[model samples]
Target: MIFTRKRQPLNKLTIAHAAYTLQKEVKWLGITLNPTLSPNLHLRMVKTKTNNTIKQLTQIIQPTFGLCQREARILIVGVMMTKILHGSIIWYTNKNRNTVRKKLTGRLFQAVQLSTGMMKQPPLPCLELYGGIRDITKQNIRLAHNYLHTKLAALIDDGHRTLIWKDLTVPQPIHPSPLNNLIEKNTLLQQHFTRTETLSPFPVPPWCHRGSWKENKSGLALRNLELTWRAPKG
Candidate 1:
């Protein structure tokens, strides 16, 4: 299959003497990735799965001849929700993604109410009040931050540095930094470094200018500091 993105060259190219057909989206590693690299398709898939799970749990957690409120709550939260939010950290980024996540969260909230013999169609705030669940969006943000922190820590501890870190030593005048994508996605990492002028497990490179901690009091100021991994060749 040919993977042609929007507004790109639509040249019909094929290999091994076979023609290829263009597809709008493709399933990769159990995630549906689209031409725009958005997670909308994956969100819909998750929504369906969550709905089915909720329905099945609801039947088993009925008030009579079923699990009690506490038992149902534990099972639904620990098992169903966990299954639904497996890879949320990677895809749950923008407002649209949050909206999709809210749909699942709302369903979970309703399921909690149903299991507890409460009103099924209660308001959002009422659900939080009774269900005692944190804001789903905030939870996703915290999960994303934790995932990023783990990745950074592992990169720092690796015996052999990645190619991107290795590129920091090379004086490439024409190319941009390979770490730009990482810095863009994980803003928390940038904020952490900005507050503390320390990149542990890696020494301050010659390219990175070490400014006094007092020089930038406001953590909001995003200064373009030249960070490097190699020492200056004096």
Candidate 2:
């Protein structure tokens, strides 16, 4: 069975004298996978789920029984945001995000405004800054970073070392590519391996530095270290 964007008829698969046809999309473990492996359907599902949660939160937070702004902020951070972003990093892609970015951002803006007790939705940036909430893009990146960090840590662990090495192995080039050879010939690629830049002897001090008796006790003070010019003896 085959799935395609075109309307062409597809051949049927027969098993035990029974015929089965291809599907345009398949749902597995709550994620929709299409033939192209495109994330459009996944993004749509995420948007739908997020919008539903936002709607529910809005209804539950009516003035009469609504939480105060502070409590609402906590709820937004702890619950609503979590629900909206669940499994986001796994299927997130720039193309899918570009397709639904505005709608998703608008929904997020509305959710934040409602939760924070704002009279009206502010500009997205203002909502992010003044409302003390990260924009959707940053939040998505953060989730991806944290998830990758944890997965990498596990992969590098002794029990999974082999798995890590296996996964990290690069696939062999099936067919030689003229473009790849051309790219490898570039001077920049050679320069990358030849560049030699030694680390500076004295870099910027740590954020909190314990000082000597002559220096300030508070670690907040920036250390003033200087090197005087000297001429070599002839």
Candidate 3:
């Protein structure tokens, strides 16, 4: 409750900034946001026999644009990387936050050629990870950002290349013009599909949604108030 309320405003602004950054970086890339959400689903299963938690999810095999199913696996990783990068960069710099506010309010919302949608199902993998969000509107931005930053960073790094929108909506790119390439060379861009633990400094500019972790819980639940007395031994 406390964290959500405190983060409400920041989250919105952060998304706004990211939208702007994406525009500047991807303007010539010819990727359109899917307005109709194909809706990705992620499920978590606990193996009773093994007494271990296993995560089950679909691949984020989005090809430039289109629709696909995927797991919420990327969210935790992006947030983790963001939490670390935001702290180091934002704090280290002595700049104004006014730009970040401007980008979120002005650019992200103001855009063209985008396909957008949210998950139709509930009890999502993210619910357990996020302690359960009530609606997609509140959390989808972060989810998408996590997906884009970690997953789509390739598009940003590849620079001046045209990618086939192999996903769903548009065939071939709307813009074949060369892109300026907003990123520097890094190994993660090559390995996003295979490696999971790869980390990099988030590329959000001076003004963007950047935050520190209030708390990041590592293990699963501890006490079950009602079942405290009869709980199985660890």
Best by lDDT: 1
Clashing pairs in 2: none
Question: What overall lDDT goes with each candidate model?
Answer: 0.37, 0.34, 0.23
Off by over 4 Å in 3: 1-70, 100-234
- TM-score, per-candidate, Cα-based: 0.24, 0.25, 0.17
Give the alpha carbon lDDT tens digit for every residue of 1-234 in model 2.
Answer: 122323325556443334545466543223344655445665576667766666665655444232343443344443324332433522454454443444433443443334323324222443356555446644443443343334333432322111000111333223222111211222444535532111111211111122211111111111111111121222
lDDT by residue for model 1 (34-66), tens: 667545665665657655766666565454332
**TM-score of candidate 1 to 2 decimals:** 0.24
Report how far off residue 223 is in candidate 1 (Å): 50
Model 1 Cα displacement at 221 (Å)?
Answer: 48
lDDT tens per residue, model 3, 185-222: 23444324321111122232222222211111121111
lDDT of 2: 0.34
40 Cα displacement, candidate 1 (Å): 10
Off by over 4 Å in 2: 1-48, 58-67, 78-93, 121-234
Q: Give the lDDT of residue 99 in candidate 3.
A: 44
Clashes of 3: 12
